[model samples]
Target: MSRRILLVTTLLLAGCTSGTPTPTPTPPPVKSGFKLVAFDSCEQLTKDLKAAAKKSVGPWGFSGGMMRTFGAVPDGARSAASAGGTADKAAPAFSGTNVHEVGVDEPDIVKTDGKRIVTITGGSLRVIDAASHKATGQLPLDAWGDADLLLSGDRALVLTHQGGGDVLYDRKMPMRPAGAELILVDLTGAPRVISRYRGEGRLVDARQTGDTARVVLTSQPRITFPDRPAARDDDEDRIKANQRVIDRTSVDAWLPSWTVTTGDTTEQGKVACNDVRRPVTYSGRSMLTVLTFPLSAPKLDSGRPVSIVADGDTVYGTPTSLYVASDQRWRLDFFPGRDNRTVPQETDVFRFDVTGSEPPVYRAAGKVPGFLINQYALSEWDGHLRVATTDSAQQSSAVRVLKPDGETLTQVGEVDGLGKNERIYSVRFIGPRAYVVTFRQTDPLYSLDLSNPAAPRVTGELKITGFSAHLQPVGPDRLVGVGQEATEEGRRQGTQVSLFDVSDPAAPRRLAQHHVKNGYSEAEYDPHAILWWPDTKLFAVPVNEGLLALTVTDNGLTEAGQIAPRASAMQVRRNLVIGGELWTLYENGLQISRLSTLEPVTYLRL
Candidate 1:
């Protein structure tokens, strides 16, 4: 295979709400399984908060109080015909941002509508016209670090964190305080910030359906601890002091605060108590707030905010439902005994109904035995939600099907003991069939039959030498897997792309395999780094520092070519197929290439 190195100095790229009075609390759904219950009043919420905090408080704060955040998935293209591209027109067929579901767009570093390409790089939002093939306009943002954005018609919502990316800490250094900043920009002409929002925590993720965007933020309680304790103070003494501080903290201090600025006016408020809900069992340590914003509105206002007293690590959204799952890391008891036993390894999932343009309504809650790997671990289909989990204690993985009854998600069917002694690496649900990959020493790909929700059983299993970290469906009967090629001893070598034929659920087989020694691709773990053009049957992934493009065939994967921009210092973060041109986004600029020939064209430096 031939390789193209497009050298260019200039081309490279880079990449809510306020409180309001809520309506009367809806009665909890009537289900025999677990559920989330809203607090009746501020007084009741305060009482519940204090009691939970006081019991859970310890020397460092709430016991087992660390929060986990997952990486966002990559861009997705709907179809070759969409985005206003036709062979008869001056522009060729084009592709939009790669997303998980149709009509549900995720925030990404780059986006396009066939005519123009918009991206964020070096704290600035840049736009390039496809016709002119040149930089058109730019807007400098007040961003702290790296950023991503969601596009809706002539509007763009750019998300940034205060600390300029994830912070690292050590015994000698202090943890940097972080917050999330969302800037709403108008894309009618030159991009300009029309409104700005600052929230108390980092952004979990955001998803858009049509003109509405829903953002998820996770925040810890805003309580200060003593910098230095007395010399005589011990662990127990410090624990007591932290508990006392929790006792004096008011309900407002535990909720997430927000400030939204529009022109000369600004609104500031914390999440309302009435809008907060909690599971029957909670540690009350973290607040998970979901804010809904109308992106096409004249000006961005404080969004409709609804919050829950739980931690959100993974967020998944479909057209009609949004699911948030947490690993539930809190301790079982507020006070620790000598044993210091913690809560069981489990994940709590909350479902919200997002049918209309209104704010999402809390619909149901459920618990699974093990924790989820990422957003792909949860799939909703045919009025049933399927969850894949791996329990460390049991040394096995399982797929459980749950149905929402009134206010709870009750398990209807379960298949456990899968890949015993291994952990789940990837999972994908395609209609009635499900594929699960688990790996320790070797990879076991399990095909499940979910045609009957109440009796989901594993139909077939394929043991391979490596594991796939991310699985992408090619069509109705094929899947493309991106992961590591490992040894018999479970040692990973490099990046491997495998073609899986699932035409027969009872017996699936690997059609072809391509291995890159010492190669690593972000697409292995972050699906957002992958670009699949179905019309051409081309799969492009960021391997090492360049974009590796592959041609998928029935017999095998043909290496189309590797395209790396001239800016070798910066990594290729994303790639887009816009009107016969392959637009590659680097950390600093953009590179345009001829999609058919994989040849370099003009490049733009932002």
Candidate 2:
């Protein structure tokens, strides 16, 4: 679900009392304070969940719970214009999906392999031939909500939700309808569903390595509660009723249930109770499950799954590690009229080993003082996990380094006193260096040298009037920032693109900037919405109502042209380059244009 629950809370950091400055000795390193412990049996799991519910459940419900490839062509990609190119012409170069890591692929609404483009939109899956610039095949999907897909050699793994948004928990009768589906599609010929896996949960996010796809999901106990309170019923009465519902709820109600349909032969199952684990501290209101699927399989099975009795909002993955983080909310933070600002805030991160063809194995767990902004706030480098966090109560931010020690992520190094009054707006980790942007009245772009994990230090700082919500690397010496320009008073005015020269780590400067008044781009919050074609130096971000295309000139970014797709009913979700054509994706269909001149080529209404 795209809906985010804003978590602003007080951070508790232990330190020496503030008084006459006395020379205090350095303290010893800190170890992870928590770890995941498996339940002895389903009965114990049920008892622990019930106890947590009785202590934290609210009147409405348990609150909270909530490329790769550096532009390398995809594997088995055919010639760009093979479907219709003349014998004398050569296939034009194409770019693949923009990914955080080289080998790890992130799921998106659209994907291409030069010759053909596969996309899920408007409640259907469509494939378009790049050379012909026409829809070659189509498959109508069921009544699933918004969807995205991942591509293998000849298969596509599509993720969809029953309800379009986050699972809503309010004073409602059956709660809001919520479920998720994983549809495997065959792309050898016409795009068609081969197998469908449906489950009761919200699709968190997913990552793919080679042909193996791992999907993360979160689900609440399937126990029905009462509707809106009557005129006479108070919060106390509702809370008691909710507690009673939890009392009678079975352990199966908390486990994720799923059904796999392959050619009408359906099978059902639930995450085995013995396979579930939970951190030392958790609300037990929700659970996080990770399912593994091999896209090359003829029929999809309810994947080899692993479950944990905790809620996760952010999922960050590498080829070897998958990290799930959740804001450790105070039990009463969601209660009526409770001031969250006074509640102690912390974030718990669980690490899983995702190597080989097997399911993810829970490795270790850790805790930090404050919550993270998103998956970007975390970066795994050289066996150590680096985290950036903002403490709202402290009005400050910090970067920490932790390494897996035994069954814990032990804190090894840390640097504090960053952006005194602002939180982190963007973070990018490149090798041994890290860049962070924090803003309130002014944006402070700080470059930190993380070569020494135990002693990371800020190398330079640049205070600008605007803040970048996303940062994309350029040739190892520059960065392209997409965000909004703001006034000195911290009021955002419009969309802004900036080119920075970071060749000198201690003295980074903005080479050029472009602004669009009163405009906003989805790239600010979603890096997937932005595309950077390094070959042609083309950078595109969806601004305001259309695609704002820019080219990286020798000195700065220049407005190449704009592509206003004909699919007016849907917003421009993604942009890709195939051969010499630029393909723009909308919910209704696809639009192709010449990459050089931005001339319209053809429109495919799927």
Candidate 3:
């Protein structure tokens, strides 16, 4: 949900070619503030759930169109389960002009160690040499059944979904959806799987810090609700029957079970129940398990899993904390339809302290009076967390500052009434500053000063013709934005890239803007898909079947040329500069080119 996908080009960065020494980023802090409750017995589980269901005012979107959008045990979940990677002298080298975030690392389809580039695509892992610009080795990722990988040192964690035959949603017949699996690969030479961590539930998302990875697994109880009748003669009987199922269910039945497979030996069972807990409000429809394992460890982590009975479908993370947020859009989209007096739908936010290598420890849970646009809407700074949200009920966008004290995430301050009648298009938090874009007709980029958690105030606002879905910090006061170009009446035209000068927080201005005709970009939503080299002022954005490389300067955006145009949908997935050479990674292969000329020098087919 956050722009939290992780990975990079020979991303092993010990021998960074930046010609400067940078200090190691501080790891996240470890804290266990509040405790969630798991079940010690089946009776308690059934009793608690009955109470929750009895008190719920509206129906939870467990199935139907909302399930198709938010309630699926998805094979494609978008949380970055990246390893907080450090460059080991002996590891491959990888570096980027500007890393994803100061405190969080986002994963990509391809990562490099500077000397070698590693890519996980189409159930295969490919390794390419930076100098040779050719595939050095390749390995299939089928062991994990089509997965995304996170890199740390020379180790890669492959995350995938397995099992669950056909059940997508619908709690009618008891059936489990595809679960999650983690595979460890050693990338010293040929990619080889060394270990596997198996768990129940579809992959929700994962975040890593330094050598540790926090993996999120989400699963739903196999509800035995009877099929809908063509014509119901007794509605009350069916309702009571469902209630009986809830009241008779055990916590074990609600908890997801996972297994560890090391070589040929395997161990499987439900995680310890004491480690699980539910929030104040719940559907009892889903359980979220947050697991942690060292990227460097060759053996499966024996640590007990930290689980929550949350209905979260989205997550965001910083080096210090990982946030799991659930949207009530389903609530708004389902039940009572949207209207003026629909009250306000709030987002439930949970904090997990990942500073420690152990699976995230429960820190706090809070609610904001709106739904988050994505992961970019969440950031952790100093000792507090900041959230950007779009409150449709209030007809406004706002940023809320939250402080985790013991078990509660108390709101310290807020700046609402932003983009009145519109919703948030994107959010980027940099240090004590937050940049928000909201669009309905004209796009307004609002800059807010967050230095004071107790009082956040908007310092500047710039109105433009388009909205930005992603924002990148180019300098201390400069930001590069990518999103859809639109007309004054809010008719979206194509992709747009804009450079904003924010040296004066009180008077932000757009230095330059560029548009891609009849085009759209993934980087607008997936920030990791962008390739930026500050040293050369070249930024690559994948559009359509190729890449749009541009020289972004204080003056304006200068088009270099399109790179690697393919006829298929598996076009350019990633672009990176390793060892000063530009490389584009596609699903089928990779292309290397001259950074200066933008000409293809070689192509390696996977």
Candidate 4:
């Protein structure tokens, strides 16, 4: 294959000499034709076998064993009854006139029509009347307990839990079968189950493409158990043994499968491979999935390589390709009598085509030397696939846009001026611009102009005191950044909501800021997710305590209402929907509220 390189001088605002330029280093050639050599001597054979044995035993002893023994079984292992378990009750009363509750526990709400909101909650599909703020009808699936839900248009996909959780630290438990079912729920009509399909592994995620829903599963490998305890008549020994059993068992193991639900029939097909990472819907017809494997053989005597680490696991899809940002390390092999192992240092981006017959057509992008691409976001615009990579090095925080072919990666811009320890947390594409949130020493929101696809330039920035946990774009030139703020004394003050205007690509200005008292003690205000309502201009903030809805106006943001499901406990808004109605989630069940009335919509039984 041929290669091309582009070098451009970056102009810093600090007023440095412009004429002097540094030469970019040429990337090393990709190695091919090197065959996997078989061990000939007894010493070589012993080394190879030992390495394989260690690789096999490490994961089994720790993660697989624990899952087999103590993890929840397929039928949902009942936890030893706790004193605080709550039971389902009749729907709560509605009080507030401007706000009403809608649904809870992983509620994904979408505006099916102007007056109706369709939601997926507690593994069921329901339609809510916008004006009445009440569930018009619902289709319940109590059989698939504790299922993960995903929605695309009028289709709802539920991934039923496979068998027990894996034993991560234990080594004595036997591997149990991990399985899940894919159920399709149609929400356009009376909300009924359209089709169902079964698979061998747990479902991790589901992507909807037209009438078909492709579910991603990771297959659980059978694990071996320890025959005897490591120590006899010792409490520590017993505890260790139990931990080993839990570690060895496969918990939530899933293999990839695609279920095509059309009309009244469902057909299931499996991906020809395993170790599926992230699956995403590319367009309206096909899906994109990422498959990853180790680039080098395991070493028995050495610890795991750190340079090639896998940190963030997110699958971003464009129209034609999928961008996966994986943690990778450069493994330097120094074996005597082996072919001098030096070129192509075993670290970099592995690009794959989504439409290829081989599925994952992986090819090296470029040498990210001494740095790993931690997190990335993919966007498709005007027939170009744009990738924004977050560099691992704190001092060299940069974003690169790569051509879909994976061969050409251009460094468009860098987030400079901040402290070396600052890191960019999230990146999202809004129209022809890319918005990035930087965290760590300094928290700021930045907007970059991608009008020239190959040469992205940063046009505007807004420095805020609080670090953003999540970001949602509201309109063409406006966005809402949500997170918590901390004082200079290292004390968390409260939750923060900030709105920015990016009408001018080169200069983004903060339009408003909202600070709400968290109510809980200083230590309990961790923010997780944020959602914006374009129609009502409301921001739904889910924190450690509960959910809060705030309205944004010309003056600023005002807390319209709040919901406290529990005190001082970690309650995540697994999902949020703000269409014609309002929905919040809890661990045990869901809470629905009406956005206009600020009252309880209805509490449906899970």
User: At residue 405, what lDDT does model 2 achieve?
Assistant: 89
The model with the greatest TM-score is 2
Q: Please, what are the lDDT tens digits per residue for candidate 4 over residues 1-606?
A: 000011111112221111111212222322211111223543433333333323333212323211110010000001111000121132221111010011101112222333444544554656765456567777777544345444444555555755654322234554455555655566666877766555544433322222222333334333343444334435344435534543443322112344544455555554432222221110011112332211111101111111111222223333234333322221112223322323331223444344411233443233232232122244556655445443334233444444433343333323233223454445556657777765553465777767765556666666656665445556567766666676643255676677777777767777887666653211111112344554566666655457767787654667877776654234634334434356554544456677775577775433
- Candidate 2 residues lying further than 4 Å off, grouped into runs, are 1-27, 64-92, 164-176, 228-230, 329-342, 565-570
Predicted structure with the largest lDDT when compared to the true one: 1
Model 1, clash count? 19
| Candidate order by decreasing lDDT | 1, 2, 3, 4
Determine the backbone clash count of candidate 4: 75
Q: What is the lDDT of residue 159 in candidate 2?
A: 87
> Which ranges of candidate 3 are over 4 A from the true structure?
1-42, 50-61, 64-84, 88-100, 143-146, 162-176, 232-238, 330-344
Candidate lDDT values, in order? 0.76, 0.75, 0.67, 0.40
- State the lDDT of candidate 3 residue by residue for 228-317, as single tens digits: 452663545555656665566566666678777777888777865566688766766667787888877767754367777766666677
TM-score preference between candidates 2 and 3, better one? 2
lDDT of 1 by residue, 539-576 (tens): 88888888889999875799988886465437788888
Residue 218 lDDT, candidate 1, scale 0-100: 78
User: Each model's number of backbone clashes?
Assistant: 19, 2, 38, 75
Supply the global lDDT for candidate 1: 0.76
User: By summed lDDT, which 10 consecutive residues of candidate 2 come out lowest?
Assistant: 67-76
